[model samples]
Target: MILAKKKQRDFHQLSTPWNVVFNLFAGIFAFLCVFPFLFVVIISLTDEGTLAREGYRLIPSEWSFEAYKYVFQTGDTLLRSYGVTIFVTVVGTIISLLFIAFYSYAISRKSFKYRNFFSFFAFFTMLFNGGLVPTYIVVTQLLGLKDTIWSLILPLAVNAFYIMILRTFYSTSVPDAIIESGKIDGAGEFGTFIRLVLPLSLPGLATIALFSTLGYWNDWFNALLYIDNPNLVPLQSMLMRIETNLQFILQNSQNSSLGLEALRNMPQDTSRMAMVVLATGPIIFAYPFFQRYFIQGLTVGAVKE
Candidate 1:
């Protein structure tokens, strides 16, 4: 009884300090990650004149919705961009997940004859690619996808790294016995994959979906390269235009009679922060839904037998 008590004491002594240290580190890390975003939110609500006079503050001297007012002064364009971004993100994510999951599942199956060949082909893409100029020519000239939504979706539909990760997850997480059972039950190949395999791979699929959603939502370069129509502009591209126009007006403030008046009314600083808030706010809400699956998918994929 005495020895048992001493052992318990030793464990408690060791665990207590380690637990304290771990919590301390985690708390600090969480604060570091969250503080920048909090700062942005605070600045977005801060009065522009007060911000200019005092610089950034965690708690502002005054609050104003003027930045948001300026942003939505022409609400139609902002609303249209939101519609475009939402459509692209949703459609792009669905298409990407379908192609990626199907391709990854095919190569993960041992019975598939060309699995090794196809796996190598997918992996080979990671090592090399056609130059950007050639890709642009193919996308624009040959395919004639330029100035269309397909240009945004098709080019980024499949990422080599995501394919490899999903393949690894399938290899490790999916049981051969289950697949065999589906076959023994007289299920067809497509039926088995659709009903059994896909259902079993929800965590992996959700993880990849989150990645694709973020990629599609955050993409501006694709629009810049392929789209010329303002009506087709996504939120990021619209924000980019606002940023550039603001810069131009500020830089040439001394060159024109109207420059000073433009600068006076621009909402230059707070509006930039407001744009960031607008662009990122909805996507932040999505992270919580995917958080569990993301952790599970990453952990399962990381440990390969």
Candidate 2:
């Protein structure tokens, strides 16, 4: 009994120090992570004039809805951009998930003789690529994807990392007995995949879908590279234009007595912060819905088979 009590005391002594250190580290990291977002939120609500005069602060000296009002005054542009973003997110996520699921499922099946060959073919692109110029030419000239929404959707639809994650999940989580049972039930290859395999892989699919959707939502590179039409601009690209180039505001602010120079000198710093909030709003709002799936799927996929 004395020996057991000594061991228990030692264990508690060691664990107490370690727990304290862990809690201290975790508290600091959590504060660091949340601080920037809190700052942005505070700044977005701050009066532009106040922010310009006082600079940034954790607490706003003067609060105003002017920034939000400016963003929503017309409402049409924001609405249209939201629609474009939604369309891209939904369509891109669906197409990407489908292709990735089918490909991963194929590669996971041991009976598929050419699985490794196909996987290597896919994996090879990750290490080497046809450089930017050639890729641009192929996407624009050969595929004729330039100046179109498809330009954004097609190029990023299949991420190698996402495919690999899905493949790993399938190989480990899915039992061979289940596939054999499906086969014995006279389920066709495609049917079994669509009916059985897909249902069981919901967590993995949900994880990849959220990631792909966020990618499509945040993508401005494809728009900057290929798209020129204002009508086709996704929310992120539109936000980029609004933030970087003061010309859009100047052009629209024609009704105001302020000249281009004065408008250019307006509290643009605060407006830029406001625009950042606007650009990221939807994704941030939608994130919690899939956050659980993302954590679970990534954790499961990261474990060695």
Candidate 3:
């Protein structure tokens, strides 16, 4: 009894120092990660004149919502872009997750005769591809997806790395016993997966969902390359256009009478930071919702049994 008590006491004493060190490191890491975002928010709120004269500050002497006001002044266009982006993100994420989950599960099954072939096929994609021009030609000329919403949705729907992660997770976390029992109970393959496998793989699903959300949200290059219609432009693309227009106006200041004033009055610095805040605002709220699963999902396929 005494020896057990001493062992318990010694374990706690040793663990206490490690706990303190971990907390300190974690605190520092989190602050380092979050401080830039906080600085962006502060800079966005700072008055343009003060921002120019005094530079960035943690606590600005003067505050203004002029940058936000400027952005929303063109709210109709911005709102339309918001709608486009939201639609793409929601729809794309759903389809991509479904494809990833189903495909991964299929390849993970030991009974599937062609599992090795399919696995190699998926892995081959990660190693080599047809390159940009050929892909562009196929998407534009052959498939005729250019300037359409499908162009955005289809291209990014299948990610090789994510598929492998899901496959490995399903293989490791999902028990063959449960699968056998389902077979014995007269459950179909699809039914067994939907009922049992999916529920058990929530952690991996949530992690991939978060990844897909961010990818869809931040993607502007796709819209830039494939889309010609202004109505179909996503938020990030629209913001890029705004920045481009500002630069254009500044560059041609000497040519137009109004250009000088436009250059002088452009909310250049503050507006950039404001755009960051706006783009990231929704995603920031989303992180906490997925935080629980993220830690769990990262361990996918790492531990056997």
**Top of the candidates by TM-score:** 3
Candidate 1 local accuracy as lDDT? 0.91
Residues 191-280, model 3: lDDT tens digits: 999888888899989988989999999999889889999889999999888878877887899998899887777787898889999899
Model 2: lDDT of residue 205: 86
With candidate 3 superimposed using the best TM-score fit, by how many Å does residue 206's alpha carbon deviate from the native?
A: 1.2
Q: What's the TM for model 3?
A: 0.90
lDDT of 2 by residue, 1-305 (tens): 99999997887675777889999999999899878877887898888888878988888779987767765654687788778888988899999998999999999999999999989988998899898899899999999999988998999999888888899989998889889989999998998887888777888888888889879988988888998887788888887766665666666777766665568445566666777888776687787888787777657646453
| Winning model by lDDT | 1
Which tens-of-lDDT digit does each residue in 50-120 have in candidate 1?
99999999888899998999888767999999999999999999999999999999999999999999999
> The CA-based lDDT of model 3 is what?
0.90
Location of the lowest summed lDDT over 10 successive residues in candidate 2 = 296-305
In Å, residue 281's CA in model 3 sits off its true spot by: 1.5
In model 3, the runs with Cα more than 4 Å from the true position are: 1-6, 9-25, 298-305
Estimated TM-score per prediction? 0.89, 0.80, 0.90
